[model samples]
Target: MSFEVGQKVAGKVTGITHFGAFVSLPDNKTGLIHISEISDSYIKDINTVLTVGQEVEVKVLTIAADGKISLSLRQANEQAKPETTGRPKPAFNKENDRNYNKQPQSDQAPRFNKSSAAPSRSSYTPNQNNSPKKEGDFDSLMSGFLKDSEDRLSSLRRNTEGKRGGRGGRRS
Candidate 1:
């Protein structure tokens, strides 16, 4: 009934809660399998994956000073699987391969120039050369942000005024 960290043990899932599942261990002690420790992928609901009285192999993650046990189903499953060597093959893309070997256009320079002074905030103009400006460019970005803010404020004001029936206080 002695349990050490990283030891794989089988247990019966006795109960399940929103946060975790309670597993009855060999020593009559129960350990908790946290929602995060249940799987490598996202789990919206634990009941979808586990049910009462179901047998599961869990790795002993930790034993707190107070004797609380933390277990991981994911780690136990991983330990049971054999390890593979070498990196996974990169996905092939014809366009990416062509672009990777191509040289940059001679007319185009690096995006930033160390010699040139930074443009002043006031002097900045967007879409000057008819080329599409990046969304992060200052002028267009500020204008879009201001417009969105104004729209939200106006919506809030209209909703409040409608609720109040255009009056400031209750009529006597």
Candidate 2:
């Protein structure tokens, strides 16, 4: 029987390699399941995940012109399981959005109360003697970032210029 892409087929693991596993499909066809496709998580050893003569349900991923079939063990397993999200999402509509944020709603999480969190403005004022604040100026922020990067590069060079000894070093 011929297999098409995305077709779930039952097969027996015929061989295992460091990179993947060879599975014998019907009609004497064989497919390779790459190590990455073996599991949802990392599999340190292919043997640990599969063995010769083990039955598995694999989804056909690709059928190359050269008669090579790429299969996925994980994809087939995912198909067998149903997804579960705790709460059903509300359908988006203009009416629901218009009422949002006007008042507190039980369904929504509590919003951060800015007024309650901060001290009264009359109680806290900046001292006139302090340096000018750099908040909200794009030019000042960009220049500060560039200056810090330049200083870091200069210090890194100072620390590594001698330790990076290699054939590229200039002849004295």
Candidate 3:
């Protein structure tokens, strides 16, 4: 039998594979219904949807020069459904008046209050003693850091000076 693209033909499922199912067509011809073409929904397994020797209606999608045929069960099923008029007419709101000529009340750009737009610093107050309390708090933190730095420098200088004096002679 001569097979053409878009022709719906009934065939028996001969083999099921991970990728697709092979359907044996009339005249000893065979076609593959890819896992995707098997159904409109996601198919995790082809065995769940098709079985060997099961009959299925498939639409011929393509015929390769090598005599390979590609078929789609979904396309055949889609052809069975009646076509709709596209979309239903949208329902209109009767109460709302369509104002085509009314200009916006104010043409000037809308004014926004600056204070409410962003968070204020006064809203947050840290409770911990280590946390800075006010603007001058940073100065106290800097003074403490400076004192600690000076103490560390003095201790390092004393240690290095003693080590240098004890080991005055160069290694022989």
Candidate 4:
């Protein structure tokens, strides 16, 4: 018998593999229940969840052109869950509101407040040099670096210049 998508059917577990479990359906057709669809929670081992000859109810997910069926055990259980109420929830009253419409104190800057478990920026000072940096200091810092670099390069060139000609002093 042909099964429609979303159809829940009763079957028996015929085989189990690392990837999935095969269920023998009504028409002697076997469908594969992927490892991910086995349970809501993670299942490290399919053997722990299912065994050979175990009865199971599965929801039909898709039917391939080559007569392959994709089934879901989780979706089958989901179908049996009772729906939530259609009635609307009551509106919240200002008095009953948790915050009570009170504005946060200016002192308590929640945006800057991080979890106590983590190190706060205010507590963790990145200034390892113990120097106070200002916005106008970038140009001065860059110029100082350039001067230092030029001095090093000039000294390197002077030291290497005498060694360039030969391994030993040339014969006259």
RMSD of each: 11.9, 10.7, 17.7, 12.3
Candidate 1 lDDT by residue in tens digits, 25-108: 997999999999999999999999999999999999999999999999999999888988879998988777978778879899
Query: In model 2, which regions exceed 4 Å deviation?
Result: 85-172
lDDT of 4 by residue, 46-158 (tens): 99999999999999999999999999999998778889778999798988887987899988868754455587567653343445654568887787668667877888877
lDDT over C-alpha atoms for residue 102 of model 3? 55
lDDT agreement of model 2 with the native: 0.88
Q: Write the per-residue lDDT of candidate 3 for residues 1-172, one digit (tens) a residue.
A: 9999999999999999999999999999999999999999999999998999999999999999999999999999998989876988767755564765556578666578776777778755433234565455878768866876787788888788765764453344
lDDT of 2 by residue, 7-106 (tens): 9999999999999999999999999999999999999999988999999999999999999999999999999989976799889886669776677768
Give the lowest summed-lDDT range of ten residues in model 4.
125-134
Local error of candidate 4 at residue 31 (angstroms)? 0.4
Q: By the lDDT metric, which is better: model 3 or model 4?
A: 4
- By lDDT, the best candidate is 1
TM-score of each: 0.56, 0.52, 0.51, 0.53
lDDT of 1 at 133: 51
3 versus 4: better TM-score goes to? 4
lDDT of each: 0.88, 0.88, 0.86, 0.87
**In terms of TM-score, how similar is model 1 to the real structure?**
0.56
Stretch of 10 with least lDDT, candidate 1: 125-134
